[model samples]
Target: MPQSKPQESPARKLLNILLLVVGTVTFLGFSFGPLFQALGPSESPEASLVTEQLRAQADGYRAVLEREPDNPIALRGLIDTQLQLNEPQGAIEPLKKLVELEPENRQLRAFLAQIQQDTGDLEGALEQLQILHEKDPKDSQVLQELADVQLALGRPSQAIELLENYLKEVPEDNDVRLRLAFIYVRNNQTEKAVALYDEMIAADPSDFAPVLGKAIALSSATDENLRAKAPELFEQAARLAPPKLREQIRQEAELSAQRNQPQAVESQETAP
Candidate 1:
């Protein structure tokens, strides 16, 4: 009996199956993406917990201060939170209260000084350090820290004096010597700086800091005579330094040589 109905195309059926598979994949992705994100591994659970706890404690202290604003403990707690959070500016008010309540607390005073230093309030920090130094004149740590802060405040002369006085008691202190060299450099006494570096190198020739410092200082000298000495210092530093720094020192020496040639030519031209 007559021709049978043409069979439905297999291509149409395959296309329908492909559409169904894609639709299912889209549905699954949309549903699971946020679920996986919510359950992802956290990068800093401990810090997050500490921050949350501090916030809660801060809020509690704030509420207490709202009711009894003069409470010294509440003020101290708020100051501690601010310090932990690295918001030293925010700590100033509570610290002022703590200082008023406990003027004799040297630890509190030192903490205030440190926070002030961290916040760039060097004058305030210096005042606090002076008071602390008066209380404990023999504290080398305090002296060193104060000297460093003074240097940061553009008082390298004071830093040098402090380091000198500290070295009188703690002689053989290489750390103090290093700090003194830094102060000398800051004061533009490159000769003194180089001398200190030389002393340090004589004591421990293997130490790279002094050698590098000497090389750098010699490379920056203004006098052509002095500038001629830089390549030797750089070669010495290159030998003593690690591979990475050795390459850098060699490059600097080459550049310094290039710079010196022009100056030498200029001087020769000016000669009679």
Candidate 2:
């Protein structure tokens, strides 16, 4: 008998694909960049014709689904047709049905969650994300996305807890760590935020992100001693920054100095 090739797991396949295509991380570690290139709607003269054809196809899929509600083929066709038509709302129903039918399919669940997020059904997205997280808590992409959804829903504490737990298991994920620090800054937990940046700097003093993050965090502090450190940190960050960002960091340093001057004089006059 001939040997059959082993099928690759979806998660492993996703990793292989991302490894081949992943690009630069954003300054704030906001994203790991695109997973796939988006194919925007066509603007050519045949655009109307394309739209008409898609609508007809969608109607056909809907008719088939009406007769055979459990037909995965019709469900998938309708989902694709709705997405290409730029009507994500229309895709949600069929996608949900498909997801229910294939509860064990990770890719399908992730796709459905993304569609829910895009269509502003954040609660729905959160539900799906929570399920994914429970299944694989250490998935960096899922962790970041789940945290993002929590923040969007005005639940910073929940986001913080999620990141903190994930970090305990995967402390080396600097991107998620950076994102957690950014969240602390936004939540006005300045000291905690700066501590995270300090840890990152201890790990890699040459890295610009923690340097810049610490500078900004301290610069906003009300304590004179804390606020006083911002200018020098900002200066260091500017030096560490690339040429394109150097001027902007330098400008921040100058502003920090100006803001701290009044407090500096007050502390000087009050000295023993």
User: How many clashing residue pairs appear in each of the predictions shown?
Assistant: 0, 0
Per-residue CA lDDT of model 2 for 51-125, tens digit only, reads 888899999999999999999999988887787787878988998898899898877777777777777898998
RMSD of 2: 9.6
Residue pairs with backbone overlap in model 1: none
- For model 1, what is the error of residue 39's alpha carbon versus the real structure, in angstroms, after optimal superposition? 22
Identify the candidate with maximal TM-score. Answer: 2
Worst 10 residues of 1 by lDDT: 28-37
Per-residue lDDT for 33 in model 1?
Answer: 14
| Count: clashes, candidate 2 | 0
Candidate 2 TM-score, C-alpha based: 0.73
Off by over 4 Å in 1: 1-56, 66-73, 84-86, 96-108, 231-272
Candidates' lDDT values, in order? Answer: 0.65, 0.74
